[model samples]
Target chain A: MSELTDFLNSSGLANLDWRAAVMVAVGLLFIFLAISRDMEPYELLPIGLGVIIANLPLTGMTIFSDNLSGHQESGIFGIVFHYGLSFWNLLPPIIFLGIGAMTDFSPVIANPRTLLLGGAAQLGIFVAFWGALATGLFDIEEAATIGIIGGADGPTTIFLSARLAPEMLGITAVIAYSYMASVAFIQPPLMKLLTTENERRIVMTPPREVSRLEKLLLPPMAMILIILVVPRSAPLISMLMIGNLFRESGVVPRLANAASNELVNIATIFLMITVGTQLSADRVFDTDTIVILGLGLVAFACGTVGGLVLAKLMNLVLKEKMNPLIGSAGVSAVPMAARISHHVGQQANPRTFLLGHAMGPNVAGVIGSAVVAGVFISLLPGG
Target chain B: MTFDQDLVNQGLTLTAIGIGTAFGILIVMMLLIQLMGWLVRIPARRAARARMAADAAAAESRDKALAAVAAVSALMKSAGPLESDAAVPAKAGTRKGAEG
Candidate 1:
């Protein structure tokens, strides 16, 4: 019994930090947000649980090796951190692949102008870039990576952050995905603030039905454009388009099903654990992290407004009226942003149908945000 | 610091800044492409609408032509030199009956 007590005393539990305790509370909050608020429950729940478990005070489980001189080589969580999460930055790309497989490009094909709103919405990316640089919160690469959180694209943010600012990858990704999940709540108020009721209620004529040929052509054309314009975005964009191509090719039913299902699940598990490991108490609860979260919210708000206002301007110049509410769909939160636009539009006009049209900007937002990330990464001095 | 250390530090800083500028340019280009996409669609949408209207008109014309052809066939049948069965087949039928 005395020998066992001595062994326990020699362990690192005596050095357990207070930050670990606080992180547990934060992790629980994420769980509440996921379960109670239904905010990205699929991702946030697992990530939240992983964070809580990873941050627990030393239980000798995290320690991997011990020396006669009392030196330890690794912790249980450390093993998960190094091998499971750090090396496998594969989640973002796979998630994007799933998104691509699920997306229908028909609306964008019908009204290509929505692509412009998608691009314009990325204004926040640059805005946040300057914001990060001017504030001196982080260096150029890290700042650019963090600023991509404004694009509301988790995969792009993760890809860029992993490449440019690997250390900041964890928080940046979390902030990006969290804001995207909650963007529904954040965007509606901003949309209401910018446009009048008339603009919101304006019912535009329905877009023409898109053809199968156009549907097949769109993802490839979009991929080609990305390859020519910004090679850096090709990884995420190409994979996305390929996933979509698999779905549209009609001959590859098995590949499409796999890309959208098992492949996504496997990638997500790795990604969530890796991301959760980054929330190591010491790193995430710091002053810089706090600033990153606040700035992320600002960037998201700006992107939302930028897209809507540009759309409203287009409405002014064009003969056919475009509903300004569709602009809020520019944040690239996918079905969520489109759904919010539809809901808000319906509130203004009972008969207004904006779901299909809103989808154009919604999908555009994804591509636009990625392009934005690429530009910022390319232009920044250290990036 | 040593020369090597100084070089490493400078390289790291430059890499960070390079990433930022690259990302900035990417976003700007996207905006430009978006603008061009919007402008290009105006003419295309108008042309598509025009084409649709023309197709509808063509479909209506084809229906009228088919109707005229059907009417002509019906009139020709009714206005034939031997319009009724009685006119052409009655003599044949009477001869057969007498023979039997």
Candidate 2:
């Protein structure tokens, strides 16, 4: 009887806060949504696990502690959290290395004008900036951190928020990646709302062939430009470009493999753990958290509209037809945004194939969002 | 480093420079992003086009083979066994022997 009582006491059912209970349900929903509905399991799995770990009571693992050595021994997450994230600014750049290795520059190379989509998608970032200001939720620095949600790049949002609004970093990252993961669902309806069926079905003429020399030249050229304009963005953009150069150069497969596999895997584990440590229900349950999450949804929606509208405007001026659905690809969710573009185009015309074409703006959005992050950090105070 | 900090501390001039520098890099990355599209898109687009062309060619060849087979089948059906049997070697030999 005592053994049975002890087992029950140790179970997850015991000593649970109602809020923690609710969060555990949310965690289960994340798992369900990921497996049953096939919604971005790569990110949601870690985030769901984070939520569960954070909600469990009396673990005493995440809290800081002192050891018998008389030197302070931090929590499981504390050592890396302080040294890796809080002080060093390490996670974001290293994560970019993996992203770079995975990205193929060929789509962007074929349609240089797609850079405009990147620029247009940034409209949401600035709008969120003003929105945060008007709401009085934060000062300019913290406002800048929250506004980066419109950037649609998760790592950059985490990096900037950690630096500028360490307190809000957990909520900001959750909102950013959640919206990014949902981009496929949210973007399609938003895309249809903004674009006519004919506009959605517009078929672009095939582009001409590109050369090996051009692919080799692109990353360095981009880096030089990024460094010259926004030095702060240089770290993230430089690492991304270097990763790209390594992939295209054909000689650096070893480096490319390492960046994409080993380095990215280790950084992701660390970043996710540190990110999980921040999800103390006390931090996430505040009014400010609600506002940030709401604003993040708004930012993502507006960015979708902003890209589509800009494409329509360009179509009016240019002789060539631009499928407004492809414009929705101008958010930095990478191939997911492109896939959504393809899916929406197919719904309009079964014969239409837009995946390859949408990729141009899809990759452009990555650069565009990064540039916006640089702009916000530079214009706003608190760095 | 302290001297640089002192210069930055001097006024808005350094700040403006910093802002300008940020914008400058943005413009360059923006350009590079476009250039990458141009570089990548052309080849990808061409490959897609070539693939479509190949598919069309294969489809046309398939149709032609089907049409040829149908034509042969139809001719055989319309002609009937009488014409076919008359053309056989035994009948042909019988006809030649009769003439001889």
Candidate 3:
């Protein structure tokens, strides 16, 4: 009888706490959303599984402890977290490489004015930065990290967080990805609210074909120029341009294919899971976490508004009218944000095809966010 | 390294610098892309036109060759004797020779 009682006490069910239970529930919810709602299944499914695995009692899947000598011993997930995320800071740049290989520069090159929309969308990052500081709840570094969630680029957010504020890494990464997945839901309403029916229905001229030489020259020129200005962004910018050069060079199909497909897939699995392990309930269930979440939502909304407003302002001055709807895609969520812009525009006018135009700002937002993050890293209290 | 002191002032400074630099860098990138596009456009158009002209010339030559082959085949078909008639005469000559 005593043996039975001891066994019962040692079981996972016996040791389960409210925090772990809640985390498990959250993980389950993410899984459900990924499977049924089809929200970032590649990212959320792994993250959800990681959450469940990390939260389970005595699993020892992810362990972090320090010895009397103050030497830290880390488990599998912790090793991934340390080496991939913090120590070498490898995963995000690799992900950027994949993104670069996959991206089509023609849309952005066809319409350079839309790049400003991408820049404008970064207004949300600053707005959130200010809001986080005003709360007096977070330090400047944490606030900057939190604010990057508005960028809607998961890799950029992780990159900035790893450099500036490693403590809030998991939550900010999760929030950035959550918002990115929910772009279909979050962007349309804000886009409609910000723009009028006529503006949403507006159709711009078709983009001219970007020359192969321009495509080949672009990655190198842009990389050299931007890095010259912000040397701190060299790591991310250089990798991104190199990957793009692989794609545009037309001589290395094998390397481009490998970077875009296998390399990205492997990195994403490790990155998402490691990020998920950071969401232990004790770390997440705090007033500061709640504040960060709220501020993140505001940041995304402000970014959407910023892009839309800037597009409207540009239309007042420019000869060729612009579709304000495409501006909302400037938040760096890739084709998803751009697709949402196209969908909203199509509803207003079946003839209006804004996908190409939206893609300009969409990709530009990636660069803009990386630049903003670089600026924060350079100018903030800590280098 | 500590961010706890004068956080708002630092935040405002960051906001100003970050926004200003982002816009400036991006605007410059935009202009560079435009300039590059313009410089490359002439050569690109020339290459495209040359390719199109070469394709058209090749297609025209191919069509002419095909037409000539068809005309020659038709002329040969019209001028040539029927195989049955020619074979009948040969067969007849063979039978006559055999009978002789």
Candidate 4:
């Protein structure tokens, strides 16, 4: 009876805390959303698995430290989290490379005006920054880290959080990715609220055919110009352009294929799992995390509003009309935000095809967010 | 820095700077893209002209080849029966000579 009691005490069920159980439930919910709703399966599924594994009472699947000897040891997930996310800062840039390889720049090249919309969308980051500062819940650095969640870019959010406020990395990354996945639900209502029905129905001319030479010139030119202007943005922008160059050069199909498919897949797994391990109950259940979540949503909404307002402002001076709906895609959630724009436009008018137009701002939003991150890093007090 | 003071001072300043820099950088990017487009078009135009010339030359050579093949066929057709008739008579004469 004594041996049995000891065994029971050592069991996971005996040691499981309420917080850990709550986190497990949250993880299961994420898994359900990934499998059933088919929303961001690659991100959420691994995160869910990581959460469950990390929370299991005595499994030692994450970080373990000995306080007396001042010795530290990390499990596999913790090592991945440290190397890929915290220490080496490798995963985000690699993810950017994959994004660049997968992207089609023609849509952006077709209409350069949409780049302004992307710039406008970054207004949310500042709004959130100020908002977070006002709350007194976060310091300036933490506020900056949280504000990037408005950019709707998981990698940029992670990069900024890891740099400016490593303490908030887990919640910020999770919130950024969650919002990205929920773009389908979040963006449409905001887009509709912001734009008039007439603006939504407005159709612009089809984009002209971009020359192959133009495509070939774009990546390198962009790389040189951006890196020259904002030196801090070099790592992310440079990797992105390199991947895009491989795709456009037409000389290296194998490399392009590997970057887009295999490399991205491997990186995503490591990134998502590592992110999940960071969501230990002690970190995630804090009042500040809740505030950050609320602030992130507000920031996302502000970005959408900013883009729409800018588009409308642009239309005031322009002869050719623009559909303001595509402006909502100016958040850097990639094709998801663009697709929402397309879907919303189609509802307004079945004939409207806003995908190509939205893609211009969508891709530009990636650049815009990276620029914002650079600005935060360069301008912050301690930075 | 304290929250209220920082929000009022540095926050506002950062806002202005951030927005200004973003718009400025993006505008510059837009101009650079335009410049690149214009620069690339010069070479593209030249390449286009060169391609057109090469295509015309190729067509001309192809037409010449076709014409030459037609002329050869015509010559072959016109000369074929006479050559065969001459050969037939020479063969008959040789056979008669051999018999005698």
Local distance difference test, each candidate: 0.75, 0.75, 0.89, 0.86
Model 4 bad stretches (over 4 Å): A64-72, B1-7, B43-100
User: What shift in Å separates residue A107 of candidate 3 from its native position after superposition?
Assistant: 0.4
* Model 4 lDDT tens row, A95-149: 9999889988898787888999999999889888988988888888898898999
Q: What is the lDDT of residue A89 in candidate 3?
A: 84
**Clash pairs (backbone) in predicted model 4:** none
Look at candidate 3 and give me any clashing residue pairs: none
| CAPRI accuracy category, model 3 | acceptable
Question: TM-score (0 to 1) for chain A, all models?
Answer: 0.91, 0.92, 0.96, 0.96
Q: What is the iRMSD of the candidate numbered 3?
A: 4.1
Q: Which ten residues in a row have the lowest lDDT in candidate 1 chain A?
A: A58-67
DockQ of each: 0.08, 0.09, 0.33, 0.28
> After aligning candidate 1 to the native by TM-score, how far in Å is the CA of A197 from where it should be?
0.7
Question: What is the per-residue lDDT of model 1 for residues A238-262, given as tens digits with 9 covering 90 to 100?
Answer: 8899999989888899999999988
Fnat for the candidates in order: 0.02, 0.18, 0.79, 0.52
- Which candidate number maximizes DockQ? 3
lDDT of 3 by residue, B1-100 (tens): 2355566577768888899989998899899988887888878679999999999999999999999999998997898877776768878788899999
Predicted complex 2: CAPRI docking category = incorrect
Residue A65 lDDT, candidate 2, scale 0-100: 49
Error of 1 at A63 (Å): 9.0
